[model samples]
Target: MVQKPTLAAVTHQPLARWIAYLNAVITFKTPQGMRLTNQDLTHQGHTVRATICHVGPEPADGTMLYLHGGAFMIGDLRMYRHLVARLGQAARQRAYFLHYDRAPEYPFPAALDQATTAYLALCTDPAAGPISLVGDSAGGNLVFALLHRICTRDLPRPAAVAAMSPVVDLRMRAKSLTTNRRTDHLVPTSWARRGCTAYMGSADPMNPEVSPVLGQFDGAPPCLIQADETEMLADDSRAMAAALQAQGVQVDLQMSKGLIHVWHLNVGRSPEADASVAEIGRFLRGVTSRETV
Candidate 1:
């Protein structure tokens, strides 16, 4: 297998800086005819930054919240604009790409707090319509963490949820971390450990707020989880699916072969990535439709 130079770049340097450098050099073009609008979501004295993407006129169907993945240290609305726009177009709903605070600076519970606040703001808005959540990698961790907060606080639930190559386990105990080390070219275990440590700070690694695989999902909306079967985080998705199923939440676990982590970001360039995003869009549409019924 050809090694991923980008993944190898961060293995030995300051992760955040290297990722920022990578983000600067690598770019994805936003889909044409997509309307992009920036908004500040304020709730309970907290404000979260977000961008809304739509193909043409905003659809009245519903809304999708997309959280980008960069191991909690790097990633922003700019890096994921193209993918988010495509997803919104696919689901035929307005998509909001959240710009939550990152770690090594924001640390544990900061992103979670902001995400939950954003969700609450959306839920309270009658104009927001039915809401679903989609996140990748560390953002996926926040998806469940936010769900746990909603469940425990008895807040309104999202219409559906989707996680791509999510880092569900901060404790990093999954066997695939070792077994798939050779096959997974995108995420190195050491790099993942460093990212986790930066994000966790003094918090316990096993804290369910950080390691969402340990969180409660009893009342979570229907969830779609997609991950590459050979990626190091493969078991994270597997374990999360099992946990959600045990809690009686409807779950769809789609495992692909020989793909990089969060490959859905390659939509428009890779057929597999396009297919994966379409599937997620379909799942979100299906569940949100049922939610409205």
Candidate 2:
């Protein structure tokens, strides 16, 4: 059996600076041999910056829009560069990772709005064909929320979507909250509740858009969800897959035994992480290839 790596303790009352430093420590190495560029776009009249990563001279498939996870409060362009670059390499696709505004400074709809805007910007590019969505943790929440919005508003839909340890239910109603709390190194019930409350202020957590576990997934793109079986958010991914399936959407949910939250972010460090990225590439290829058929 492959042993799962233990995660570092979650910071007590994580602030932006604390979380940023932690992310910097975890994502220590700078990515090499990739073409990285900066692009600025306006989202709801606010400037949004995205790090565009290219693995080769030209992408053969399409572009991936990536959103990072930091409890909706931290994680940024510099923190995620290496992981996105690895994803670009493994997936054979260019990646556009957003540095969306965080909570307490910008809450709830702010991040969602920026994500939608950035996605729209990508849609305008003729070269960005069969766009796919990828995100981890809170960004995974944003990915599902954005998919709902796109379906509701009749916007251009992504060809496929993938998420890692997505926090699907803001209400924290999943049984794993109690069942796996002690074992799941990253998220404790109290800590998760606090962050969700901060992001959801005055808004109903049960609102489907706010908690995508409650949302309809009819007409949603083929979706892939990955999570650690022992993590607190395992139920979130499972329930999300069930919800998507109930709505007649194609969904693939994998709950692996030996991994921590968003372990795929480990990039070059872990063999499991590398395998997960390759699986993502396979999933994306399966979905996008069908579109051309």
Per-prediction TM-score to the true structure, in the order listed: 0.93, 0.90
* Best of the candidates, lDDT: 1
| Candidate 2 structure quality by residue, lDDT tens digits, 71-128 | 7866776678777877776666788889888875687898998999999888888887
Indicate which candidate wins on TM-score. Answer: 1
Question: Model 1, stretches more than 4 Å misplaced?
Answer: 1-27
Q: Which ten residues in a row have the lowest lDDT in candidate 2?
A: 1-10
Question: Any runs in candidate 2 off by more than 4 Å, and if so which?
Answer: 1-19, 42-47
Q: What is the lDDT of candidate 1?
A: 0.83
Supply every candidate's count of residue pairs whose N, Cα or C atoms clash at under 3 angstroms: 0, 0
Tens-digit lDDT track of model 1 for 1-293: 32245554554446655665466347465577867799988888888999997675556569888877887877776678888888887787789999888778788888898888888888777888889888999989989888877887888888899999899888888999999988987777776777888889999977888888888876788999999999999999999999999999999999999998899877878999999989988888887777678
Candidate 2 vs. truth: CA RMSD?
Answer: 3.4
Pairs with backbone N, CA or C atoms under 3 Å apart (clashes), candidate 1 = none
